[model samples]
Target: MEISFTPEIRRAGLAGAGARLLGVAAVLVSLLLLLAAGPPAAADTTQVRALLHQGQDLLRAGQNDAARPLLLQARTLAQKVHFEAGEIEALRVLGKAELVHGSFAEARAFLTQGVALARRTPGQPGLADVLLALGQVANEQDDYPGALRACEEALRLYHDQGKLRDEARTRNGLGIIYSSRGDFPRALAMLLPALHQTQQLRDSALQANCLTNLGGVYFRNNDARKALYYFGQALPLVRRQPDQGALADCLTNLAVAHQQLGEFRQAEPFYQQAIAVSERAGEQAQLGVVLSDYAQLLTDLKRLPAAQTTLERARALLEKSGDVGTLAATLVALGHLHQQLGHGAEAETQAHRALALATPIKDWSVQESAGGLLASLRKRRGDYKEALRYTELAQAAHDTLFTQSKAEEMGRLQGDYQLSQERERAQALARTGERQQQRLQAQQRQLWGLGLGLAAAALAGLALWRLNRLLGRKNQQIERQRAELTELNATKDRLFSIIGHDLRGPLHSLHAFVELLAGPPLPPDKLAHYTQRLTHTLDHTLALLENLLHWAALQMGAAGPPRPENLDLAALANENIGLLTAAAEAAQVSLAHSLTGEEQAWADPAAVRLVLRNLLANAIKFTPAGGTVQVSARRTGAVWQLAVADTGRGLPAPTPLQELRPETLPRRAGEGGQARSTGLGLQLSRDAAARNGGQLLVASAGPGQGTTFTLKVPVAETVEVPV
Candidate 1:
């Protein structure tokens, strides 16, 4: 039926009775069937089944909230009946209802149990259906890979059973997964097959779903023309379907496609239509999404007031539904709209809220969008520093998402290419066999002229030998170049490692001591203590610098490292900690040393000291005031382990670290609390440890926790001085 395109409809409230009546009728029919097959003379079971049927009807009508209690009642009844299958079904339906209600955790618990039960039922299509539901749950949670796997498994089982319609449904689910992951080609591949199946089956509802998915894939792939084409195809099918939900989705897809094409007039109507359908169906979540889409469209169209109002309604609906992800997105849209309307404070508030929500979800798209909006707001308010921070975040988020998508696409393309190559090779082999037989027949006749053939062959062989020799020389040249490049990279890494490890001691000492001196004067005893500490710090700093300079010169092909020397790592760690004690105490942090007994490491003493000093100093700096920095050394088999653990701020999240590489080591923090380094300390420690026939490991338990830097060095029996 024709739904009204109004603000109320956009908020996801039901429209006129026609759509509701049909949904109710469907629910009644389903209930009747369920009752007819249910236990005889069980009034409680009947009532529960009826309520469940009513919920399903309400759900079909898009009245998620109204359906929730009924579904809950069904679950309670199923539990009372102790019917395992019935309970599973009740849980499954309840989970689906909860999903629509945005009760993700509750939904997950129900669906997970349903999946387990379904899996237990051998040779049943119910398992595939459960898998499909699980996939949708995962999709809602934004666990794209999990969703993809679930959908793939469901599709496989359905196909194996020759359940074409179920397979089509599963394929549509996969399309959604691939589309969300930015794998447009794969999404299209999935959607097209499902679309074909649905068309063959003449399932209008399924057809609409497939078409909508296809349209989304096209939209994401930047093929607006194709997106519009698919969306238009979906619209007619959705119109014919009894389910207005499909119609709503189709309308939204079409709107998005049209919007992207700059067909504002066409887009507006579709968005309005989608909102009307969602409202009529009482799908608040869907309605919120539709409202956000329309608001975004309005904002793009420069209709600020309308956009703001639309965004507010969407936000409210999302908040009511507890859809934080969508709510955040709505906030971001609202922020942008407010910013456009010159409302600075309002914009900032919205932007901050958006960021708060977006950060936890780890949805890069939402994060980037929120970041951009926040950056813009900051810039408009003349807060350049804050603006720059947000801008960088946005850029980083964009880069990460782009890189991930590109890598996945490249991997898929590579796989496809390899498969195609194998197929072609197989075909070529078959053709070659046929040709070889023909050649053998010809060769039989040619055997009579063997002497003439041999003379020509001998000349050809001599020419081939000369060409082979030339190619061999070229290969040797290429190999030599590769070796040179390898050596250069090694030299570069060595230089960086030295620079990173060696500079930390002096630089840190200088920074800390400067802070000390700039502060109020201390008593005579404390002054003397400071002086002694500063002197010790200088000695270690100078030694590290000397070694670094020498290493750099050596790396530049200028002189040499005499040879590896046996060094006492425990002594080195102790010496460095002694130097750092004053600075650590000045920061109100305690240095806990636990190096017992001597462990000799086979390395340049200078290099070992640098590694130990850098690690200790880093721990001290990052540890908050009153936090303890613990340094310990122990022998593990042939290696000496030196670890510096801090009870302070830990390492940042793993995501930023994933981008780090050897060359990018000694990473320095930018303006954003990012780890700033040339990423050198760990790399330097690693190199120094390796030089002594060992390795260095750095581990952190996330932000604000703690960090441990361990240096594993090979034990040496005798002290050997570098000649």
Candidate 2:
């Protein structure tokens, strides 16, 4: 009911009544000919035996309703004939049928009566069978002590009577009892012997049953590998035995083992097979559990959609079957699936519902699972305190289960560690001993050759020193040449980058305007707009070319001196603002400038204009529409501070310095959402400012707060050139 392979259900019904129908029918059919042969004195006896056998088979096959009447009829006939064996077998079969049908009171009455009769009539071969049947009934009722007692008595009786088959069957049942009680060592001891006995008996059904139980024992013992091995061995045998219930259980076990081993791919086929078999048999209880587990496996594999479908199907099946236990588990699985799919609210709802159902039923396993899922859901939702509470509860439940044996598990781990270390230490010691012997041999060889090699070694040392000295000088020369060449190559690459990417953008814009003007007769405003765009593109293209020229000269170490003049910084700010007006308008940004006429600076006119142009262009590109960009200049004591500022997306954090190098160019989006970077523009501006005995400084109020670029140059004392 809990699903998954661990902490298995008490009565899984894997070997359901339906799975035994074919065997029952075969036995009954063969016995039919014996009845037809003659109506002798033993007619009632034979008939009662056949009827009892058929009734037991029908009950085992899950046909409890049909088996009940047949078993009662056999009991009546046995009583009439005074046949104790037949009567006891009939009563035992009837009790088993009642057990399957959930008639605990009637089952207990019949089985108790049968047990009483078997004891009174000791030495009956069927006594062991009745006791085994009663043990199963007791086990189902959670009467562990009574069940164990019955099983042990039956096993001893079977062994004393030399009934190998019944003894093996009793061992298998006892192993399951031991597993349920958490005594896995005793379970294994019983199951392995049972497995060997079943193999010798050559009964495929019983063999498969024994193997399956062995797998269950190993699984309960936390030995998934051995469990997988036994389940794998049981699958073919069960498949041939016409027991779909067993087959499904085997397949589910195989899937769980593979899943535990993290072989998801191998696990998938077995889950599919088990689901198919359970569905075909209409075993909704088992089917629902299998589907829930399959969904979990799918979730682990990240097949979310499929897992959702499977879990929903399981939910529906559990709903109809009224299997609250499995339904709680199904909800937990669904919650985990929803969490993985990022549906936090739905996951929380499912987890709460799972906990609600599991709590009332006192199912700690389901409670633990739901608690864990709730913890994760709360954690994802940022509810740390609530998550911690659930986490503690889940851990408490988990600890409750494993705490008793924690020491045993820890001891086993410690033993494995010590064994591994011992092996490693032994290997290391062996290696060290071998190395010491080899070192001793090498040392002796060195002593013997000491005098003979001394002169040769001295001569070799002097020659090597001269060779190293020559190599060192050559390496240094090559390194110097390499450094120069690397610098030249980098400079060439920057040049190509600017020309190919930056220059091409302005050229394409001009070409587009030309094509548009040539193709259509436009309104005066439209024509003017196109003409203005063409003029702006040409100005941009010219600026790019001038920056390229400056970069080329810088790379050649032949940059010409700046042609500085005493110019009104106010006039220069206005001229550049007018030039960028069309671009600002196109980007839906407001461009304005304010400057004092008294503010005059000695700087290369072209260089100051380029700096202002690049800064303004970057501002317009990054600023959203309706934003304002303002350029202003003022006399700051001995120098004129010309500034360009914008209410646009500012430079990135740790604003890069306005260095006279290509690498300092800011990498950010501009007006058209293209990179705001233009390597030559900023570099050329910085260089030009430096040549005029000034520095270019950049300041920003972080990204989105806007930026300001200021060119600080010395004020002109004596007019050096005509303005």
Error of 1 at 315 (Å): 4.0
Each candidate's lDDT (Cα)? 0.70, 0.74
* Model 1: per-residue Cα lDDT at residue 337: 78
Most TM-score-accurate candidate: 1
What TM-score goes with each of the models? 0.53, 0.46
Model 1 TM-score, all chains together: 0.53
Q: State, as a TM-score between 0 and 1, how close model 2 is to the true structure.
A: 0.46
| Model 2: CA > 4 A from native | 1-82, 122-125, 275-287, 303-306, 375-723
Regions of candidate 1 where Cα sits further than 4 Å from its true position: 1-163, 356-563, 566-601, 604-610, 616-620, 623-723
